[model samples]
Target: MLSDLPIRKIIHVDMDAFYASVAQLDNPELKGKAIAVGGCETRGVISAASYEARKFGVKSAMSGNLAIKLCPELIFVKTNFERYKEISKRIRKIFLDYTDLVEPLSLDEAYLDVTKNKKGNPSASLIAQEIRERIFNEVGLTASAGISINKFIAKVASDYNKPNGQKTVNPEEVLSFLEHLDIRKFYGVGKVTAEKMYQKGIFTGLDLKSKSLDFLETHFGKSGRYYYHVVRGIHTSEVKPNRIRKSLAAERTFSENLSSEVFMLEKLNHIAEEVSKRLSKSKVAGKTITLKIKYSDFSLQTRSKTLPYYINDKDLIFKTAQDLLYQEQLNNSVRLLGISLSNLNTETKKTPEKESVSVQLKFGF
Candidate 1:
């Protein structure tokens, strides 16, 4: 499959600790501090913790209260998704200038197919370097990039050098790199799956490649084909444009702490307007509305309501958030407000057969 596909240069650019890093960028004072962005309350969880917080054992999805206890000096900041998205758009513009083959994994990362280039740069590695430099120079932020013949290796290469660095894996070096890599680092190999593979003596990519396709298929069921292909670095992932508007979400961080219901509701209105504009721009409608609030204590809460029919109008989103706001009994002062619309029903044909296959969640959130 890979041989039939384009022999292109693929680059994976991933931002390190994206949310926390964005916070640091906006507020220079947060630099070098152990920072957490998410819910601050005992019941809330950390969305993104800086490396400093990670050093103190704080991590994403971990309970906020536990994170604070582990590192009492942890500084909590609410998420500002709107600002992040704006910055993401500017970065994406840079990618499109290089090539139209830009597939966004999220606001923080993307895969670029630059086999045929606009710049006519001799090497993909050099292109990646330029892209990283451009992001830093224009956005005042650092990004790590990976370069390789295929997507899988390129994704891995990006992580080889973390936090403002780049790595490349040429065709000759691929096998040796896989040989020394721990099984956990292999794409799609999670803890449970790695343990199972270990039990089967599949400890490395070389070992994994050695297994019979039938044996892998019989043991792993449908995922065997994927295992067989990935071990040999046969990645069929494509870099396609992400223009669909399945959902639009916006959030903001307060300059100061806030606990008032009136103040928080007002912030929700602004975010609702942003979401509404995005939905209108995409010419889409949504069936579900969600409200996200983060308190000064770092507690986060979300309330969602699905309508009987689809709607994308701003007033409707605002009203939905207002209802969810009233439900919050003022347990904490909200430091951030977010509005999201989901269950989008765009004006398009039924999902194409090719697109119907559920892509594995090995990467891209």
Candidate 2:
């Protein structure tokens, strides 16, 4: 029955602790040390943590203060997005040699559909290996890859062997592999969803597979059908080359909370400039402008204005943001301020449907 399903070779490549790794790569003195990229001891969040720091429970998105508590010796490094983008481009150049059907999820990870690749390589596993090798030798960073029949499984398998490792789930292995997977490990299942799944007695893929579509849909709503198909190894989503940019935003977290709108004007201007620059670089305009405000008490508020026409000019963005800022009275002392432009003018590219190929057992690594 599984053999009747269509199969496409997909590879998910993820750079290992990309930001932290780049910091270590550039400064050999930081190698093998517990380090985190981004954030400070007092006022921000860690962007990425090295393996050494992970041993101490330090991780990305963690409060810098909390990370310090976890590992007092953790060295904090500032983020250099420009440097990361430079290296990411080099890695992407390598990917272009294999297939144009590459979908970049971020600067550090991407999904590559190499079923009909430029290199004419039949073994996706070999392509993944070669790609990882090139990234390390040429870019001075380690990457992990997951190769499988579809993007979903490939993404999951990539984490199986990480930080300079690769895992391949052959066509024949997809079922058993997913069947044994923990419910928490499913790609879309977050903490809340996992807890909900646990409540439904779905502890593993096998348990998920045992539930009927009606049961899943009844409980999980629209997501139930997705779970029904994916567990049987049926994910047809293609790797899109041109992923649309839904929004462009820039934000700043202040070291000290500001009590008045008078002080925020300058900060909001700077953020608007940044957002405008990003919009210009992306060569897109937006009709919607959103103002994000985070209060000292951790409360959040957003104000949005959608214009009839798209605009990306800094002055226009700033004016819109300024309008939103004064549109309401100060909720509380503000700790963070942001501006984002959405409802972009950029059009989404549609990928033409291709004929499905019968599943074939392939070489595994």
Candidate 3:
């Protein structure tokens, strides 16, 4: 039986080493140099590592001391989030130029559904290439893009070529391509899941496909069906442009470890203020307030309290975070403190223009 198949054109764009790349682009001398963006070389963590520093195993969230040990010549640069956000805004505008179905995963990555685009173009691959070129020329930053039948394939394909590149997987080729891929490379398969899959004798997509749906379900639980469909090139997840922000957070790593409650309270106040500013900027309020603390020895802990109602006030933010902080007994000197608000209210009334162009995603191949 020949049934009409719903074909989609999805594109996933990921900026390569975004923070480090921006740092290098803004500073001429930083080009071709090993640089890590974040705090001082003596304290805190690396937020991003340039390609040069990455060669020596320096990565984001690694301790400054270890990063320096890995790459002795690594230069640490302070993160300029304001500048990065501005560049991200410009990049987002470019995506909106093609389709309104743009789902930003982060400041540097997004998924775009261009099945029926504003450009009146049917070629998703060409659009991906054009977007990458425009980002490099207009934003002075390199972007990698992947075009495929669905979001899962596109996101995986984007990482196939690092730095600056694009890959397109046509609908007809989706099944064959997935079969050759490693099991670990599947979208939601993490280290623990991959290890479990390996123990089950499922080492690759081909291996996974060999098992019966019932067998997979019997072993892997609810996720079993997810693997069954995905291995057969089936995923229905859409690029949700109207997805609400679940959380707003801001945190800082101090140059010196704080031991006293006074110092912690002051830092929490600053962090709470930053979170409030972000919430206000987004015009969103959240009910849950979380306080994250990283000790000098690299251990991390978090304390959270959910309120009865949403709040965006700085005073309330500080007070909530302060209360959480004081409730916990000091076990060690804290190297970093952070404040975040989750359970956010990001609902927005849809405009007629948005309603007219909203995408309807299709499932399966």
Candidate 4:
């Protein structure tokens, strides 16, 4: 029965603690130490943490203050994106040597379709092993590889044996492998979705497979259809190599919460200016303008407007954000504000007239 399905050899490769590992590799003194790359212990959010730091409850997007509290001796290093980008390029080049169908999830992770590779190797498992070896030898970094028939399974399997390891799920073993997998472990299933599934008496892939399409659709809406197929080992989403940026945005967190509309308007103006600069630099314009607000209590909301014509001007972006800000009721003190443009026109290649005035406001509060 499974022979009728189109089988593709997809591989997901993920670097192990990319930024922190790079720092550790460059500085031997940092090895075996809890390291965080982003900001100092006083402020800023952690962009990445070493496995040692992770063991101490330090994680990315967490405040530096909290990270220090969790791991008292945590070493802090500023981000070096230029170096990371260079390393990412090297890794992509290595992937291209094997297959052109590479989809990068981030600077550290990518999905490669290698059913028929340049080496004429039929075994996806062997190709993944060689890729990992090549990355280690050439880039001096460790990567974990997951091999399976499709992207979803490959992504999940990559984490099974992490930190310079690999796991392969053959076509015949897909269903059996997913049966015992926890519902929370499924791709795209978050904490809230897991809780909802738990409440609905679904706790594993086995349980999910028991639900009929109509029942799942009636309960979970559009996502139910997704769950229904994924549980039965039926994911067909191809690896998109040249994924376009859906939106470009700039946001800042204030040191102190502002209750006054005047203060929010000032912050919004700065954010809008930064967004406009990014759009102009990319030689792209968009019709949709989005204003994002985060309250002092951490509650967030977004308001957006789509215009008939595309724009990349700072004045127009700020004006649109200003209108959206005034239209909504300020229910709570504001802590963060962001502006974004989407539905882009990438054909325009206009050179920016001036340098961008970008700002990074890190507020401990």
On lDDT, the leading prediction is 2
**How does model 2 score by TM-score?**
0.93
> Model 2, stretches more than 4 Å misplaced?
327-331, 348-365
Mark the regions of model 1 whose C-alpha exceeds 4 Å error after superposition. Answer: 1-5, 243-282, 285-365
TM-score of each: 0.71, 0.93, 0.88, 0.88
TM-score of 1: 0.71
Clash count per candidate: 9, 0, 0, 0
Per-residue lDDT for 202-319 in model 2, tens only? 9999999999999999999999999998998988888888788888899998888899888999999999999999999989999999999998877889999999999999999999
lDDT of 3: 0.86
Best by TM-score: 2
- Give the range where candidate 2 is weakest over 10 consecutive residues by summed lDDT: 356-365
In model 4, state the lDDT of residue 335: 72
Off by over 4 Å in 4: 259-263, 346-365
* Model 3, span 248-359: residue lDDT tens: 8998888888999998888888888889998988999999999999888888899999999989999999999889988869779998899999888764444233332223
Q: Please provide, for model 1 over 18-75, each residue's C-alpha lDDT reduced to its tens digit, 9 standing for 90 to 100.
A: 9999999899999999999986745466889998899999999787779999999999
Question: Per-residue alpha-carbon lDDT of model 4 for 1-365, expressed as tens digits?
Answer: 34545677889999999999999988899999999998668766689999999999999988788899999999999789789989999999999999878889999999998876798887788888999999999989999999987789999999999899999988778899999999988998998989999999999999999999999999899999999988888887777776666788998877677899898888888888889888988878999999998886678899999999999999999999999998869879887788989888753434333222221221110
Residue 62 lDDT, candidate 4, scale 0-100: 84
Between prediction 1 and prediction 4, which has the larger lDDT?
Answer: 4
